[model samples]
Target: MDAIKCHNLSFQQGEKCLLSRVNASFIAGKVNLILGQNGAGKSTLLKLLAKSQQPSSGVIDWREQDLQTLPLPELALQRAVVEQQQTMQFDFSVRQLVSLGLEIQLGSELVKAYQHVADFDVVLNRILQICDLGDLAERSVLNLSGGEFKRAHLARALAQIWPLQQTAQEQPDFSGKWLLLDEWNAALDMRHQQCFASLLKTWCAQGLGVIMVVHDLPLAQQLADRVLLLKDGQVFAEGDSQTVLQKTTLENGLQMQLQIVEQSDGKTMLLPKF
Candidate 1:
């Protein structure tokens, strides 16, 4: 029951229906990838999950609790979201920006109280290292390259839900924590992509639940435990990765011929057949 479940979910803008009756469940402690062409309501569904936007109809439940009824302050401690486009108007340093995520979870007052604590520094430093932002920690957010900026925002989100009270020797329990990402790999190069992919797997192994919207079919095949394919704002296919990411299912849902190559390691690879 520790999952994100949507029942008959729908979203509308004027007369346009962005999503229609999308009933889906994404389990905890695994990577859930949402795939679709543009306008397939992928971003809409992610926003709804993040509670950044309200659905016109239906219910979204987190661990069998109605998401809308949860207090925002309480929810901030349980989940974090990273969106595709991030714009910063201020000249805060990378460290400052990442610390703001902790502030959101702990509130301004608690942040001021804990800013100098060893635990706070430990959590912040670990996130910066994991996100590859340790070197850029003191640099102004305005000066970062696209990839670095993306990593900074990701570090911030991680800091939001990071377990702050755990001892250094204790394994951090990420159960009930969720990370919602939209196009998380967009600005990263191949090296960073592989690096973050490994990091995601490690975190999920530690009980972090991830729901991501991505266009990378091969990456999804590599990481997804569950895959949801969308078409025309509806659930075209939803199941385990091996069941939902087949060549025929992808071709029909995406309207293109794609090649699926089975590697010697038993993993699959996808390629566009253009």
Candidate 2:
């Protein structure tokens, strides 16, 4: 199965447990949203799935293969992650930073050797356009506004797992590739957020798998195919969005009084009562 599975997953720092016995399966080619209040271990679980932090106990499997056994380079090709915070020490241009993702896909040495190849330029240009960073390609990363910087990083991550070898006639296949995002909408404005939602819809339909940790319930309600609710480092509930995001389940899990309103357009809206 092309899926990410966690079994008895737990994480701790010293004596403080951040996650406890988390077991879940996220299918490929779908949007999976993790929702919770602050300090609910949402980011912790995302880190574990990205393999950036090892679980103190239990295992994570990618396509039925043990995550720990995969080589770092191979894993890099199969997955890309965008964290809540981004920091850069060097003064690299947005184009340069984004190119690093391509370097990971095709070795740095090869990129340095053939930096001006036609195919490389094609892929990079497409990614820049998809991420809406074409105009900022040459801008210094340090000079970008918060929203611009976030989009730049998103473009880079997308470049990391882009199907570079596929010919123009071949359909893009992202069956084994995964994108893990943590608070990706933090700096993005409403317009950009909508653009991102549309992009995810298109990519997921083309076999891209996405797992994101977000606090935006309304956006999650619109984008998620599967929803996982975490509370106090545990899975309070999880299932298809329609099944898990009911009024009572969300209220109990998030400790908030929420109203689910049905619009004339036949869309559901989640509103929190103050």
Candidate 3:
């Protein structure tokens, strides 16, 4: 099923257009990766999809419902967004920051009820464990390393959609939810990146649709089930990984000389021209 559909979407700032005539469909249970050069409007496209910015023209639909028309609370229940940069002015603890999702999703009364029965603490603990933030739960968010902060925000995003209150008696599933991520792996080392990738795969398996903007070509190639190449504020190429990610497409879209190598294990690697 398609989680989101963008038709002839365009965005502009003053007289300069950032995205023009963009069309795409993000499918459920798949990782939709967007790639582009620095000023190619990848971030703009993500903001548009997340409804943080409105398009100058065209339409975006979530499950065939008009996206812009949905109430903010309604939209929040169905989708979560993790932006490329996050700035917090307050000295919030890491655990408090992650718990914000519960506040947003379940409100005080429901969150309290869930904690009473299912134990939201247990749920939060497992989330922190997966994001590798178990040890830093009480630390101030301002004191964390860059990688740690990113992982903390990722846990928060996941918490927004995770059915934390579901017990063994309830039917367990994650369906009709979407995660829009912008450069989520930008701060991570290889180990954390792989850990996040594995977590994303598990979520996708449970039917969460994810759309991410990433600069790491090889990592994108490895994790994306589908890819969209953006150039000059428009889609340059888009399709399955093997179709949209290729030597010629990357060279043209990124305006760089690149080499694609096939390893003995049949995995592809992308390297820049020397």
TM-score of each: 0.95, 0.95, 0.93
Candidate 1 lDDT at 175 equals 84
The sequence of per-residue lDDT tens digits that candidate 2 reaches over residues 1-274 is 7899999999999999999999998999999999999999999999999888999999998888999998888899989999899898789999988988877876657546666667887888878987899999999999999999999999899889988878856766777789999999999999999999999888888889999999988898889999999999999999999999899999999999998788899987888877
Predicted candidate 3 versus true structure: per-residue lDDT over 104-194, tens digit per residue: 6665465464454346777777778778888999999999888888888988988888775577355436788889999999998889999
Superposed on all Cα atoms, the candidates' RMSDs to the truth, in angstroms, are: 1.6, 1.6, 2.4
Residue 154, candidate 1: alpha-carbon lDDT: 88
Of the candidates numbered 1 and 3, which has the greater TM-score value?
Answer: 1
**Which stretches of model 2 miss by more than 4 angstroms?**
108-116, 168-171
In model 2, the worst 10-residue window by lDDT is 108-117
Candidate 3: worst-modelled 10 consecutive residues by lDDT: 108-117
The better-scoring model by lDDT among 1 and 3 is 1
Computed on alpha carbons, the lDDT of every model, listed in order, comes to: 0.90, 0.90, 0.86
| lDDT preference between candidates 2 and 3, better one | 2
